[model samples]
Every structure is written in structure tokens, then in C-alpha cells.
Target: MAYARRLWEGYRELLASEEAYDPFLLLEAVEEWPVFVRALRRAASKNPAEALRLAKEVWREEVPLRVLGVRLPATKEAFLAQVGLA
Candidate 1:
């Protein structure tokens, strides 16, 4: 999707911010998150509606959600590719 080259790196940079978040929150965010949900939807069934549900569920409203300054289709894996993580 051609997100900015830095978006992937910036996503990785989030690892450094681990200390800022509550560990429980991070765990819940990951397990019950829309991100993972969409990922599962794409992997297991590929249902568009289920995928959309996951996207909305995981959407972080309290925290400003950004698209890595890249395009929406630009996922973490794709972003990593830009930085050679792939």
C-alpha cells in the first residue's frame, strides 16, 4: 500500500514505549485487540464482515490511532519490509 518508509520503523519503535503502557493493558490490547482479530480473520476465514468487526474492535479510540503515515493497507509486516525487517 506504500505507506511511508518510516512507518514500519516507527511501529517497531513502539517497542521502546512498552514502559509507558500498563502491562495488563498491553496484554489485553494484544489478546482482545482488533488488530489481532483482523489478522485471525484474514488467516482463518477471510470473511470481510468479520475482518471489519475486528478492525473496529481493535481500533484505539482513546489513543489517537494513526496509519503510520503510510497507506491503510500498509501493515506491520509491510512496514518492516520497507526497513528491511522482512
Candidate 2:
């Protein structure tokens, strides 16, 4: 799980160079959003305040988008539920 988190972090770093790309579009392109959701869930369970801050950072509008260009997935609510915050 730690490794997965590190991998997600690396992916986020890569996104820094993809400023022309929509964050959601870029995230789905690489299929790292779900990994991020899972990691955020875990992080939320351990730290509520920090998790909330991170959530706001990642989901500024909290809008749901198609996952992998197919399915609309509500990852923020799902993560909140997983962390007992919903």
C-alpha cells in the first residue's frame, strides 16, 4: 500500500508538466485516479483534517466525471464513505 501511494505521488508529479491537459482528463488517461481515491480514503481514516484539506485540493468543485472515458464514478463521496466521513 505504501508503494502504491508512492506510485500515485509520482504520477501526480508527472501531471505538473501536463498543464495544458485537463486534470481530470489527464488523470483518467493514466488510470491513476482510482489509486488516488483509495489512497485518499486510507489517508482520511488516519487523519480527518488533513484528509479534508487534501480532498479540497484534489476536488475543488467535487464534480464527478467519467472514469476511463466510460463510467461516471463518484470517487470523492466513495472515499469519504470509506473513511467514515460521509
Candidate 3:
């Protein structure tokens, strides 16, 4: 989990920088975890903008773990319910 957090921080930093970032690097950092990749894809499919916002919140530890524990490959309804949006 610490390693994942560090990767997320690095990814965030790259995005914040003025220089162009590598998509492959970001993919490598994130795509190694199939569960996370699935959850992210699901979130993005539902709402791209919100998914990006949530990614930032996740890195900041602003989102509660309970909300995040909706289960990997979660149904849209399940995801919404855990986040109190259903």
C-alpha cells in the first residue's frame, strides 16, 4: 500500500510538472495492479471527470477507505451506494 501511494504521488507530480510526461510510465505504475486498474476503469467509465477528481482525493487520503472498499469490479450501483451517491 505504501508503494502504491508513492506511485500515485509520483504520478501526481509528473502531471503537475511543466514538462511532458510519459503515458507509458503512468501505465506501468498503475496497470501492474489488476484490481486497481479495473476499479479505475469502472470509475472512468461512469464519470471520467469525477474519476480524475477521486484519484486526486485518493492520493490526498481525503476519501474514506469505506467508500473505497466497494469491491473490485464493483457494480455501478454498489459503487454508488458505498460512496453515498446511490
Query: Which candidate leads in TM-score?
Result: 2
Model 2, position 71, has a per-residue lDDT of 30
lDDT of 2: 0.55
Whichever of 2 and 3 has more lDDT, that candidate is 2
lDDT of 3 by residue, 11-60 (tens): 45644567654667555644544454456556666676666555545534
Which stretches of candidate 3 lie above 4 Å from their native place? 33-56, 59-86
**Candidate 2, residues 17-58: lDDT per residue as tens digits?**
535656675655457556666676777678767777665554
Candidate 2, poorest ten consecutive residues by summed lDDT: 64-73
Report model 2's TM-score to 2 decimal places: 0.49
**Residue 85 CA displacement from its true place in model 3, Å:** 13
What's model 2's lDDT at 54?
64
The per-residue C-alpha lDDT of model 3 at residue 53 equals: 59
Q: What is the TM-score of each candidate against the true structure?
A: 0.27, 0.49, 0.33
Tell me each candidate's RMSD, in Å, in order.
12.2, 5.3, 11.4
- Residue-level lDDT tens digits of model 1 in 10-83: 34445446457555644544443344333444433434454333334323321333322223334654433332
**Candidate order by decreasing lDDT:** 2, 3, 1
